[model samples]
Target: MKITVDLDPKLVWQIQSEAARRDLTPGAVLRERLVSSRNTLELENRIRSRVMSGMCDADIAADLRLVVGTIAAVRRRLGLRPNRRKPGWAA
Candidate 1:
């Protein structure tokens, strides 16, 4: 399949430069970016679901292979209270 659309020359140059730096074609760079954005959305959805399930940020982050701070930020943005530390838990 082939499609064509006009992009600003600067944007095209940036994409081409990125492709060269990554040793990939321009189209592959674009596809990688699209897939990365979709994956990020999916990750956020999983984070929201886990937070709603009363999972602590540390647990969610561990399960999702993400940093705990990222999970904490998302939890805060969703207007959820921080999880209480478990009894005898030490950090």
Candidate 2:
């Protein structure tokens, strides 16, 4: 459910600056920080495990119908770990 929000001008500027620094759009950064920054949920955990299991973020997000940034945020919270097969590409 997408909602329209009226953010303070300063906050918007800060978000834009952070997005530029992170090489992402403002919306992507906001989603990562606000939505995905919440405690890891069931779906998020499953996505993290799949990511840790060597599935790419693009693939996982596509399969789960979620944004890549959300997947990335969840992955960050889960910390880096070796996949079951321990592929170098996963590192």
Candidate 3:
């Protein structure tokens, strides 16, 4: 599909540099990024739904840690509480 959209200059430069390093065209790099982002979004949605449905906190924490090691820090920074508390920490 042919499409045109304005992009940040810094982002464009980074994309071009990466494409050159990988010997891929800018379009191919963008396509790969888009596909990766789509899969990540789908996976995150599935995980979030499970978490919201009362899935065990340890399991969710493990999954998040595996996917993004800084997730806990980010959550804390955002003041977002976990859906479940660990054992022995119950109030």
Better of 1 and 2 by lDDT: 1
How are the candidates ranked when ordered by lDDT, highest leading?
1, 2, 3
- Indicate the residue-level lDDT of 73 in model 2: 75
* TM-score for predicted model 3 compared with the true structure: 0.66
Prediction 1 TM-score vs. true: 0.63
lDDT of each prediction vs. the true structure?
0.82, 0.75, 0.66
Distance (Å) between predicted and true CA of 46, model 3? 0.6
Candidate 3 lDDT by residue in tens digits, 1-66 = 699989999989989999999999999998899999898667566556645665444555565555
Instruction: Please name the candidate that would achieve the greatest TM-score relative to the true structure.
Output: 3
Q: For this target, which candidate reaches the highest lDDT against the unseen true structure?
A: 1
Report the Cα RMSD per candidate: 3.9, 9.8, 4.7
TM-score of 2: 0.42
Put the candidates in TM-score order, highest first.
3, 1, 2
Over 4 Å off in model 2, which ranges? Answer: 1-40, 81-91
Give me the displacement of residue 39 in model 2, in angstroms.
9.3
Number of residue pairs clashing in candidate 3, backbone atoms closer than 3 angstroms, sequence gap of 3 or more or interchain: 0
Q: Give a tens-digit lDDT track for model 1, residues 1-61.
A: 9989798999889999999998999999888888998997887789888777667788788
